[model samples]
Target: MHEIPVPPAEATAAVPRLQRLYEHRHPALSPVLAWGTDQSGVWVAVEPNEGTPLGSILSRGPLTPPAAAAIGAAVLSGVAALHEAGIALGGFGATAVRVTTNGDIRLAGHPAAAVRAAPSQSDLRADVRSCGMAVCAAFGVDPAGAPAPPNISPGLVVTMRSMASGAMGPSADRAQAALREMAAALLSPDREMAAQSELATRAGGRELPPITPFLPEGTVAPKPTAPTPAPYIAPTPRQETPVRSPVSYDAPDRPLQTYPSMPAITFPPTPVPAPAPPPPAPAAPATPAPSVPTWSDAPPRPSAPVEPEARATNPPAPPTWTPMEAPLPAPAEPSKAAEPEAPKPAPTFETAAPASPFATFPPAAPPPAEAPAPSAPPAQQTWTPVEAPVWKPGETVPAEPLGTGVAVVETPPKAPTPAPIPRAPIAAPARRPSVARPPSRRGPLSERPPWLLPAAVAVAIVILLGIFGVIVLANRGGGQVTGGVHTTPTARASTSPAASSPSPSATTKGPLAVPNFGPTSADPISKVQICTTASPCNIPGGSPENGTACDLSSCKIEVAIYFSSVQKSAQVSYTIKFFDRCTGQTTDLPGPSASTPASGYIVSIPTDHWTVSIPNGVKSGAIVAVASKPAVARSEPLLLGADSCA
Candidate 1:
């Protein structure tokens, strides 16, 4: 495996190299396990480095001198191993090296070493020189012969210059061993601590300066003077909560809980005074006595309140009352003259005896009043005789008498007028026979000739014929009315003599009237093409192109309609259907019908493209498109390809 640092412009070329490297492996090279292309482009799976990137360390203005020496030693060690294996890295740099927290180096970035290619002299030299560059970079110095910083030891500086110049000898083992010695010397415990402290200080003083002892050993620190006492402030008293006592069921051996003392509460010695008694109720009022209903002639009296009578020591008895009844007339003495009529009793009231039948008036009002006088009976009806009708010499008299003349003529009683009675029909008297009368003479104007009827009939016929002609001519003048469309008559551009005179054959069809409109043409949809591909159906290689056939399990179907001209910007809707010839069934395309108000050219639809699945069947089917707007129009159906069953 290898790391190919392809430049931004040359990224496409790295894929081939990555593929080649996956075929071989080497210790100094990280391995690529797999590589593939996705929608996001090329990707490679390589072993991940579990170390701190050397580049990250160097990015922060280089490492300490000792750390630079350690990195240099590890890089050389890896290169020496490569040299022993007779292979060299294609390139090496800060990016190609990684250092673990434990200070071990990992080598990478050789696409060539991944394939185990033989190393060239120049390649070997380049690896060693790259190692030197890494060392110089770690020391924060230029690898182009610039003087090393004064802090780096002279021996380590010489080693950096030799490796950078590619003069470190044929084998890196010698340089690697010398670098180990320099790193150990520079990385001593005391020096390392000093370097870290210096670095931390340069990065913003995270390390504290050495602290001085509180006092010198021979002398005593002056006894800390007692801090001057702050002015006295009284502390606030805290409220103490009382502890709750334990329940009686607690273990007998347990100690009893004690509570804080509470202040005493005092109560008055005397009991509170009793509430005052309620006030007495007021006396009830006396009730008015009930009054009797009187006749209309009687005057109404004002009412007065009656005082209740004092109760007696003994229980009082209920008083008796007399119902005022009409007095009966005395009966006539018996025919024997022996029995006498019983006397009538007079009416009485609870308060007093009444002298008349109306005596029981309201006790609260006036006393009894006299009864009204009785009205006289209606006078009887009297009869006045009606005179008999005088008889004529030839008049006939009925055998029945005129309904008991006496009763019929009786005077009506003195009451409302009665309804009039319907009179019965009476027979007329017979009359003598009379002589025949002469006929009246006719006038000259009233006289009619025998030919009058036929002449009248002929005139009526002539009037009817004129009306029929007018109706026929009016109908012919209007333009023909076909399907609901209305076509107004258009004036001809120029009328030729032939157009002016109607043809003899036209006369046979109907009464010849002036023509009202010009000839018309067909519907707007002139061409329709349906196919499986999204491309124009007229184009070559489009699946089941116009007039072709289709045979597939599933396919995207698009429709293209062409029109030569439009009557208006009419809203047009399209529906596609599949006709299954095998089952004689027609199914609508499974999507919303497409509609558009645009016209005058090809209009493709559905904004969302759709596809249809052809069900397995015995044989052929047909696809049809119907435009249902502006005007109903249909396309010639196209057949599915040769029958699958066949």
Candidate 2:
């Protein structure tokens, strides 16, 4: 085992990846087992193998084409499997290929190094190149530096080169398949020849069709067929031949024919024919033809081309001096000349593209809206200058300036009032001695000393105690223990239930200490009927379904009740009833209103399944089903929750 130390964070991240890739165990690929990490590095346990690397194998001797292909095929198989699982082995090379003692090529590499969370097309193609390099190395060529392996099938060489050079498709699936097929074909030349010979014998022998190499599955090239098999004829009885083991092919005896190699060729895809152009719908307004640009120098209302005679009769005015005229809005007469509208044609396939159901014509505005046309030439109107009249001071023009902020004229000063005669000094009344009054303590309690509040509280408590004592003496005596020493009862201690409590039928509010009615309250049995028809909702055999909730939009409750087979013949009656907490009286619930949009009903569904709804505004109530006779068996009542739609 070799150890590669990575950052603790990187190792932590790669643990999951290595652990996942560990499941791909193949004789063609060594597995990596993660033993986890430590302060030193991430630990990976790999299978120990005696086989030498591809580089070592090449160092020993060059391998034959079949040998190279066999190794390449095995490695490609492992690569393809990993690729399918979304794992790509980066840094793949000759060192990654291990030749076992039994002559198997297993791929070996640091899977951690190739742990990419987001493998992409480039990564896959790089894997394909790695396979090609393995092939090159097996053929005794330096994969890192070689363009193509020497002395292998030229066709095979080209395939390998294309992959290594990134000329193949983005994925390795096709290349992987091609390598497997070639390896198989090369491994059994004898079987192939035997099959071909038998085929040839079966052929009538007019001439055998040229054999095209098998392409990858789904490749669509030209299809070719063989000559028809020998025609059926009356024949003698035949005996079955004995089975025989395949013989190992000898190289020298037949010097296997220089069989042409099959290259994987994926033909170009067939093109889809374009749909026919649409027919012009007559409803399509005759807008300016597309050949003419909308914004052109040519006038919208073009002048007819002047004839030579007309030009000679009236020498044309300077074209540049002619003032441009804005298009005038046509006068609206009651439209007596309006053409009869054409019937719209039914849209056909040809017109579907151009005819839009949403298309609408602009609303018609009458000629009264020709304000722009009249005002367009208003800027051209000529106005004559007029003289202004002069004004004399104190006449038409006032003395003051135009602005209000300024006082251009002065006003006469007002006469001062005569100084008031000096009045005799009025003497202030003699001050009387203020009577010394004690301060009244009228102030907020906050202003007083803090001890005052505590004292007042103590007094109030003493007064309450005296009142309680007086009441005890005046009426029944206090039930105090003789010792006057009593321990306070803790909440956790048990208490005796009331001597008498009303049964559920009593419906009395206070009689039964109603089991604490809030969350920590005991579970109350609120029965809901599981029936279809009110008359037989819980009937032993009726297949009535609970109608949908009265208002499913707000709240809904679905329920199902099952009864014993023995009770199938019985009929049941159901009604809703509510316990009015405020009224302290139980009231039979009224049927859901027809005016209510919801179809709220409490009934058994399909004989056994039942549903009961409690929509908003429906009184929180108990839905009861009374059996016609004594029922042999009955389903436990299901509770319809208040807060939710079930």
Candidate 3:
């Protein structure tokens, strides 16, 4: 059971009257279960609370327009009911309302009978203002100081604010009707779903704070304390083992071997080399060329006529001529008149001169015993094998020198009985110099003109551009949605409600539900915006910024209406209305009628606008949209700045 204590000052008069009031049942109230008085004061018990408190729900976060409207509507209904019964709540706020689990609204916080009886506490207009303030509080708006939230409808915002500031006059019915309409439109399935998604995107979510009772001034609630953790205890340390020293030992002894550096070998100085002999002067042709001696230092040739050898049937090649072996020539004795020349060393293969085509040599002789060592010491020398000299045609053979103890032939060799004819050297066929020619151009990937590369690049770029154009055309012609705009390139049949309506048998059971539109989607109507000369509103491309301050002379309103899935391919007609709270007046403007294609589209209304004005003492205003045909629908109040409108 729920319980409330009656103040001591009114306990006597209130206890009896409250009993009679509770005798009957009311939809806006809970039945009084029992009544009595205890040591604290007079008390009344009612049914147990079945739902969350509006205050607790507000603690979690601000409510959406629909949610706040639902609560506000229920609050007013209860207030209106109580007024009919000639009763009034002394104090009404967020805490005084409770929403049941089954979506029913119940009034709690019943006041003392004496308090309700007082005329000062029974003003109905004041109660209506309190309801508006409660709604503003649910939206996290301070009715007296903060601007209205944008999610609310303009009409509803103006109505609520007017009621809150006592500008609604004495009629509470107007405020209640406005809230009911807002709740009906905003509570639709599609609208509710969209609101939930938007709410989820919000950052920094809040949770309800701890619920507590109101305490008298000077009294404070006690705070909770946490338990301390146990003190840390360290583990015992382990004992360390003793380290052992390394063992000492002696290494084996061995004798070391060493050698003195060897002395460099020395040799006797070589004698100065004699200059080469100059070429012999050509002899007179009359003397038969004196039989050109083979050796430069050989004895003069003999003056005898030698027989020539018979030529064979086929003479051998000139380079293949074999020379007959003859005895070596003896060395000439040193001349007494000339300085003695140093003995010449015999030629080895490495030191021998290349054989000439006109030179010849005799067979090698046996090497003689080494001559007795001279009294002077000799230099070290290297010896190598000797090679026989090559024989050539029409050349005389020369002999090698024989050392002492070997025999040498002093007499010149006699010519053979038959001398072979010598053949002249054959001349080779000469090659003509190659003729120069230009470079060949026949190959793969031949050279191209300088402009070929750039021309090919241009062609490729054109092809890419053509492909891009095709893609863009496809998107435009195929009824695709881009960004948040919908495009229809081709004409489609109109399906307005005036042209076609669903039969009764085909009608759906519930109201038309609004669907959640994606970022790239269009809703039936966009949020309203307030405009002035300083910040003129523009649509279809730009959105106007809403503000509380405006220039009255150039003030206007702007909004966009889009065809949703249910309204696609139909002609929709809508109206824009302005509610001035200060003057308690409303003005309606004819909006455009648009034929939406299958792909849907958005249209901003009232291409032309006029000045706006408000009374001197008002502080709030709103804009609202109402659509007829294709199912009647309304939008949440769009609260605008009151600086100029007021």
Candidate 4:
């Protein structure tokens, strides 16, 4: 029972009529068990709700569309129930919707119309709008404003918007029908369900502050239009600069002149360079000549291309050499008198070397006297071939200059020749110095004494004996439930109604039931599942009429009540009561009496799998199972109803 605050003496006058109108059995509108006015407020007694409130849930996050739809469908049903009974619900808010532990819904804040005897059109519409606000709120919308929640499915939004607008049809029945259509739209077969489902997941996920996307108004991010292309502007013409000819002191801009070529460079034969390479036979010589050692300190640069008229020979294969006039012998070690010889103003003995034999451009002009020349390399050092690359047949091997007259040729290596001779036995030298060899690894325990095996066997025998002793001790400590339900993937529900007694014609009574509520599961969250509005109704004797309630006596319940057994012994006080399925009122099953199903030995249920057959006089209702103190956990109400559909 929660205090429903009433304002003044006038407000107190309405409490009696409110209770009279509300305290009766109804499926969706929870009946007020009792009501009384006090200085604090009007306290209305109803069944205790173990489930969370819609207001509390909304605080966590807007519910998913499916959840909102489901919750909305239920809340609307309750609201529709009230409107049908001709009472206008007042002081209602998201808090007025109660969700029970067993997933049952109830419209709780029952009050009279402002005018007492007759409800005005505006009052009915107010109730309608409240229901609409509730559904919207469940869908994560703010009902105070009129912006449609963008996160809501467009298909669902239309109906919810109309309902929230209070013009969703003049009556609660029409609003109920519209909400039903919205629920139906949530089904798989509906053409728009796919899009709605996808939208529901993201509904109201994106929110912004004032005039937020999560309000009654629709949520819609502005569509980003493609940016207009910038107008094309002709590229501005770049300034052109004239090319200046570089001044040259070594090969000048004159007619071609002949000069003696340097000798080809060679490397000393070493293992014939591993099968010495094939010559340049039928091979296209490399375009770039290996750089020759320079006499001048200037960095090497490309000289002008040599005309065919200046070449002594033009081999059909590619040119692999460049002929340049050699430097004036270096004065046999740069004699002091020769060191300062006047710098040439034009061509001289030193010609700018070309990087490739085929280059067409001449080297640029040398820097002026202000620029310092690079120091010459060490005289003692010589360049040597580091490694020889294995050459395949038809591959080129360039011939290069070594000095003024010499040249190097790469000839293919000759196949090794054999020389035959008489054979003779060679004597082996006396055994060299003795070398130690590593010892081989031995198998585990192989190197141990023979007694080691017997010791290991004795240890193993002792361990087995100790384990056997412990098993014997555990059984002696206390009794364990050996008749644990043998659960598989499915529990065979007994849907048959219970019989009064076995008929003479019936030789066997229904197989003695060892109730298996469901499959063996591993949920460490530690929750107790008693029953609820959605629990399956397995009448014990036979299948029942589909749309009608089953006999109250035929229904018995077996709950798959799992709570951590760790605290079972400490949880000493408990209450087990029946909550009427229709009225939402609880009746305590008096303890320790043969008249009732509960036994005195324990006022509380002690184990998982608590079973109870309905007593002689009790009608259809749900069971409220609670284990007090050491753990304050309650079972979802185990419902007794017509069938599983109930």
lDDT of 2 by residue, 1-646 (tens): 6566787776777666666667656666677754677887766778776356667556544544555566777777777666655566653877777766555567777465543343443455578888877766665555444555434455666666666766554345667666556556544555333323322222222222244243222222222455689888988888989876556653444534767778999999899999999655333224322121111122122245532321121212222222222221233344433644333233122211222232255323333323454333223222111111221222211112111122122235979999999989999999999999987677674377769889999999999999998998876555444332122222232465433222235343332111211121111212334433342333222334444342222322223323322222223333332222222223333222111001111222222222333333432223323221222222222223242211
TM for every model, in the order presented, reads 0.25, 0.27, 0.28, 0.26
What's the CA error at residue 309 for candidate 3, in Å?
99
| After superposition, candidate 4 runs with Cα above 4 Å error | 1-24, 35-44, 111-117, 142-152, 187-646
Per-residue CA lDDT of model 3 for 391-463, tens digit only, reads: 2223432343221112233448887788778999899989887998988777767877899999999999999
Q: Give the TM-score (vs. native) of candidate 2.
A: 0.27
lDDT of 3 at 248: 57
Evaluate model 1: give its TM-score. Answer: 0.25
Worst ten in a row by lDDT for model 1 = 289-298
Query: For model 4, how does the per-residue alpha-carbon lDDT over 229-337 read when each residue is reduced to its tens digit?
Result: 9999999999999876666645565544565678999988676446767554333234423332333222233354633332222123322344332222222232344
**Clashes in each model (backbone N, CA, C under 3 Å)?**
0, 15, 13, 31
Off by over 4 Å in 2: 114-117, 140-152, 189-646
List lDDT for all candidates, in order.
0.51, 0.45, 0.48, 0.47
Name the regions of candidate 1 deviating beyond 4 angstroms.
1-46, 50-52, 101-103, 187-646
RMSD (Cα, Å) for all candidates, in order, is: 36.8, 45.4, 26.6, 28.4
